[model samples]
Target chain A: MAAADKVDPIHQFQIHPIIPLHIGGYDVSFTNSSLFMVATIVLASAFLYMSTASRALIPGRLQSVSEMAYEFVGNMLRDAAGKQGMQFFPLVFSLFMFVLVANLIGLFPYFFTVTSHIIVTFTLAILVIGTVVVYGFAKHGFGFLKLFVPHGVPGYLLPLVVAIEIISFVSRPVSLSVRLFANMLAGHITLKVFSGFVVSLSAFGAVGIAGSVLPLAMAVALSALELLVAFLQAYVFAVLTCMYLNDALHPSH
Target chain B: MFVTSAYAQEAAPAAAEGDTHAGTAVPAAEHEAFPPFDAKTFPSQILWLVITFGLFYLFLKRVVMPRLGGIIDVRNDRITQDLDHAARLKGEADAAVAAYEQELAEAKVNANKIGQQANDAAKAQAEGTRKKLEAELEKKLGEAEASIASIKAKAMKEVGTIAEDTTSAIVEALVGGKTDKSEIAAAVKSASR
Candidate 1:
């Protein structure tokens, strides 16, 4: 067997260059993963744009659905982030749509999973966390430091509590990126492995084909689970982003 | 220590494992080397970010936000209109209640006046009737008294005539013959004594 044929399933997750290009000192390769990420954003915008192009008094089904999704996230932001939460609506709403579209697009055969990459997920996470920090400082000035110093803690335990708060605050971006990337990575790999099994078993004529049925069934089940996860990851991302924003807005609680 | 060793043992073959049948053993360099960015790509991450942000911003400013604001404004207007209508209705109701009460008070006063008037009229009528009846009775009594006095005078005159006649008859009988003047004078004197 050739070395190329023995490719590891895990290493299959790679950002291959879509276009071969080089700059001064930078090897800026246009990758397949970048293409999909762009596509996801385009598709998401188009979905929202087409859905809400016509604002009917008695809205059509698509319009109603899009409106419901809008209100749902708006209400969630309002609930989590309060009346002032609307300021962050565009950011949170975009994150939800972007992540949701990327995950769903990756489910197709021969598609690049952009969200499965750490850099993409980290970029979004950093944006959210950075906004929270910047906004917190802008709003509260020096008082934003109170977020680290827990209120009503006993004097003796204040130092220990502050240390814990600092760590938790620092871990926000890590946790956020990991949650999205890990889920996408795990789900896609599982689907790929199961699908590989189905292909392998089908080579042995009718008996092998019959044996292939088990993995095929498993693949189907995992695909359905992956679809659920696509929506869940998007929801989780949006909600956590809301919570962090809430902390920034209301530093006391 | 046990968990670390166990995880290391399990991970050893897993890392070495590969798809030999596909004839594509991915090099270690592919895994380790950071895949740098290329600009000629038709759809890029930064481009998508710009597009998404632009589209979303436009929708929010132009389409979605305006419609939502309109809905909220309509709701607020509706609430204010309802409150105003209710206040107007209440005002009308209060006026009606006040008017009814005023009418009731006026009616009460009018009824009391009418009652008082009726009582006074009745009282005046009764008093007038009583006065007229008493005057008539007084006139009848006076007439009766005058009639009695007149009848008494007539009776007295008749009695005087009868008494004089009887005295003259007694003097005539006692004198026995033609001595009229002397006999009459004697009789008068005796009767006076």
Candidate 2:
């Protein structure tokens, strides 16, 4: 491959298993995705625990940040899912914090993009999708299938509408997984490509050095955009999860 | 009618599409090499789920829930205090209204009592003046009757004396040698009107 066509340094997402234990002919590999997932969980827990340890009338920075996060997730749940949907607050809040921490950690110089991994994203998506399905059944029993039934429609068009509803329902996992995975993969790739340009171009001369400034600037700008996107993707995921939960809670028109 | 053809129509295309993908160049070994589901991690997934669930349940049921409950209780107490304050103010307003009405009723009764007393005193004074005028008129009428009876009595005595003296003078002239004049005077006085 040409040096110009080489994969950038940032494209090098390192993967390592935490516990290198082989058990009974099966490789139960704990990959970097698992490491980051565990780290994200721990970091989130500690931050929240420390922030709320001292409940004060007047909160300092840490407390305020934690409270803001709580209020943000709480308000989002209220807006997307309504007051009746508040029962799912703990699950949704944890998911949001986990994703947020995972995405932010990925922005570090050497870290794995857990959200970029299909297994990780798919796992989370499947969990949400499964929960929605189970909840729908628990809430409405077999009658939950009537969510596909369009009220006051012509009999002839009813079958067609029901088919569309089924397809859309099945597409939930696809859309959810793809949305988070694609965003993370694309952001990391762009950052990698720009950083490579900054390094390779700086070797030429003073003019190359000046030309390198452009890519560096672009990289910086992209990093900021990615950080914003990291927060946004988590928010979107949580919001959609809440929406699916709503469909389960109230299946009627 | 719709079901017979509809199910057939859907299944026909799905079967054909499946065959087409099966004919593709992807190696089957790679697909089989990595098991779609790993049994080893299955236990871990279940374990993690139970652990997270249990931990969260404890936190919520024990710690978080209690703190949240305290916050909610404080909020409720604040609201109840406000409502009690409002109720007390309402009671005060009602009492004020009742007191004003009672005072008005008492004032009306007092005004009526004063009016009745003024009327009673006027009636009594007029009655006293009427009785005093009637008694004065009766006393003047009694004095006038007594004066008239005394003047008539005096005039009758003077007329009797004048008649007796004139008769005595006439008899004395007729009988020139009347020696017993005193007896003639006594008989004329007894027969006088």
Q: In TM-score terms, which candidate is top?
A: 1
DockQ of 1: 0.07
Kindly report which residue pairs in candidate 2 clash with one another.
none
Q: For this target, which candidate reaches the highest DockQ against the unseen true structure?
A: 1
Every candidate's lDDT: 0.73, 0.69
Candidate 1's iRMSD: 9.0
TM-score of 2: 0.63
Candidate 2 per-residue lDDT, tens place, B64-164, comes to 43444354455568789999999999999999999999999999999999999999999999999998998998898888888888888988777766666
Q: Is the docking of candidate 2 incorrect, acceptable, medium or high quality?
A: incorrect
Listed per model in order, the count of residue pairs whose N, CA or C atoms clash below 3 Å is: 16, 0
Q: Please give me the DockQ of candidate 2 compared with the native complex.
A: 0.03
**Candidate 1 lDDT by residue in tens digits, B1-193:** 2222333343344335422101222333332332222222323444444455556556555666556545545656878999999999999999999999999999999999999999999999999999999999999999999999999999976765566667677756886554455555566557656
Candidate 2 lDDT over A1-253, as tens digits, reads 2233333332234333355444565444454445666666667677877776776545678876876776787788888778988887777776777678888988986687667754556667887889888988988999889878868889999999999999998999889978997898789889988887876788798989999999999999999999999999999999988888888887775
